[model samples]
Target: MSSEPTHQNIHTFDQATALQPAGPHHWKGQPGRLYWNMVGPFGGTTAATLLHAVLLHPERIGEPAALTVNYAAPLADLPFVLEARPLRTNRSSQHWLLLMTQVDTEGQTITVASGTAVTALRRGTWAGSELPHPPVTPAENLSPRPPTAGLAWSERYDLRLLDGDLPTAWDGAHADDSLTRLWIQDLPPRPIDFLSLAAMSDMFYPRIWRRRALRTPAGTVSMTVYFHADQAALAAAGSGPLLGEARGQEYRHGFFDQRAQLWSADGTIMTTTHQLVYFRD
Candidate 1:
């Protein structure tokens, strides 16, 4: 929506960090919103994750800040290859756009997903204010709690709770306002940047639905991403943690309304996401 620029983001952005490196995890199977619903896919959260990953490092773009992601959505079963390039370089900030789509080969692309991120030129140093960083602890300090005891979506990523007694599989703890803190990171061959975070956010519906005692299993309706600032409080504590938070809501019987707030290591509001989810079961 906005093609404006700002100061450099404190986070790191690298072309190398654009996509998760080689790994066993990837989209491959039934092309349906059902899978997207199961993983909380497409929607606003997906673009937010990808944009955040690239903008984290402002120096790469001559130090620009990321504002938000709009006008696009994610897919459930489409193969995608994300390629980003500098659109133009100005005295203030550098502009960039990332082209995402289903790929048939290293050189072939089909329209699937796409987005744009803008950052400003860094002018000075200042301490910023962040929404109350959740009270959750580091992932390594606690035991790994499973989001779903017997679901395929839950097993895809490396997850750890960051706060108040880990959530249980049968707590009936569904409340639209209750926020859960967790470190969602990718393991193995993947470098695990924002892309991994996007993939992980897709699965949050089940946990929220479970707590609220709601059932969902299909359709990805819509999403919006708003990123304010980046801090270090949400990153890994040592070598095994990547901090982040997701907040969303559910509406009607088949529609899911949601909002997400992502933080940094030193308590910065990395980004915010809004999305609509549809259930299948």
Candidate 2:
């Protein structure tokens, strides 16, 4: 961890909602507030922060094509260090490795997360999406989802649940299917960017919680995302809500796999993501 002191720039509350850059290859996570989850900081924000570290790096090239983040351990509420390095660079693509660690007062560094991201330059090529957009209530037609009592992170996004029930331990009717479709955007409306979209990819609740009627302890172990669009695409999206769908594929040995897709207002595929989660019954 770089001993560089924290930078003095004061980011807007919304912009720095997840992380603030302290120096080169380093950042300070936001303090306790709406960003908090039941345990530590939300995985979405942590993922975005890792990507953000890459985005801010001067040595980065092209745009993000893929990202995979492994949650090695839970993070504390204190400031943490983010380190990003370009592992390899090809003619049209670049590969990066990232690590987020927390240093104790005694100067012991504990890694909280590690990730890999691929950025590549894209040329005009034939492209198409085989999957049709899932039919669901339009953002304008649905009511705003109310935030849960203790989950302050829920308030950060305006989520309109169009299908599949939210995971509640006592709700048996929706336990069998872990599917969910919603229109989501950051609260108060912030421009769509790689940082925001990374967080949005993880906006869905854990699959185990949605599939089982009982709420057992659950969290993501690793998450991966592939960006289908570039910066211009995200910029065009502005702060508009994007349609999101997520579901579980399998469950065994206290772990399950979940995958999700994000679509723009015009049905353009923006991103696809997958994750493995751990749960205790």
Candidate 3:
């Protein structure tokens, strides 16, 4: 159990209707179930909110390398709050804990999800050599449009689809289920940080599931994110916006597979992701 001055300080609130991540994001009343649109905890739930506690502090060093997330449950329409606490802080590395819960008018905290992360400080390997050279649109020529369909987060990033159909997640184009290319750069340069890459990786979820029923939404039990390599380093080398080819789809088995290549600007295969997705549709 790592201890800090504000280790127990949990900032919780109902995420607003828009699922916005600012002051007081909570639920409304009635049928419960968070809202018509609630933020997916993974991508939207960047450990930043949790790290804010420490990164805001003066003595923190290095960036996080590993982050793990597990769904606590379906959040309903109620007052909710989330906070990150440091579980362990040592000389070479750190571990952080995350929790989000629902609170009622009577002031009760129902635990939603608990997550952990391991971060370290060290220069990464691979200096942009040995990776595949992906096509580049350059920030100047990249034109990302708002996702008039699908989830809210998709619209925020100007994504240029490498092969998927249009500004919707439910496109009926399962012919090849090819590699997707999106010009993923934050507004005015959020700068290449660990947080941004984590968020982008979440976008690959729906893309991986664009099979079986491209025109429908699939029920996801719970998805996990594993950061195997550095996306920024790969991007700077211009290897990606790479290709994440959908490898398999088994509707009868309630699963799918997405195999992607993390190439470098010079055309080196940096890393690979073989994602498995489940659907109830």
Best by TM-score: 2
> Per-residue alpha-carbon lDDT of model 2 for 1-281, expressed as tens digits?
11222225322224444566777666666435547888887888888888887887787788889999999988777777788889898999999998888875678898889999999997888888876787766798888888888986876778888887575446654467788899987776666788778889998888777776667788999999999978778877877689999999999998999999999877878899999999887
TM-score of each: 0.55, 0.89, 0.60
Each prediction's Cα RMSD?
Answer: 10.1, 5.5, 9.4
Q: Candidate 3: global Cα-lDDT?
A: 0.44
- Per-candidate total of colliding backbone pairs: 39, 0, 27
lDDT (CA) per prediction: 0.46, 0.80, 0.44
Give the winner by lDDT.
2
Residue 68, candidate 2: alpha-carbon lDDT: 96
Query: Could you tell me the lDDT of residue 270 within candidate 1?
Result: 50
Off by over 4 Å in 2: 1-32, 104-107, 167-174
Better of 1 and 2 by lDDT: 2
Query: Which consecutive 10 residues in model 1 have the weakest lDDT in total?
Result: 9-18
Per-residue accuracy of model 1 over 1-281 as CA lDDT, tens digit each: 11222124211212112345222222222232321333434343345444643554334453325433332334435445554555677777766665555654455556555556665554557656646876666656666555455443343345666542234444455554645577654432133344433443443443345445534344445444443532332243222244566555555676656666655445555556666666554
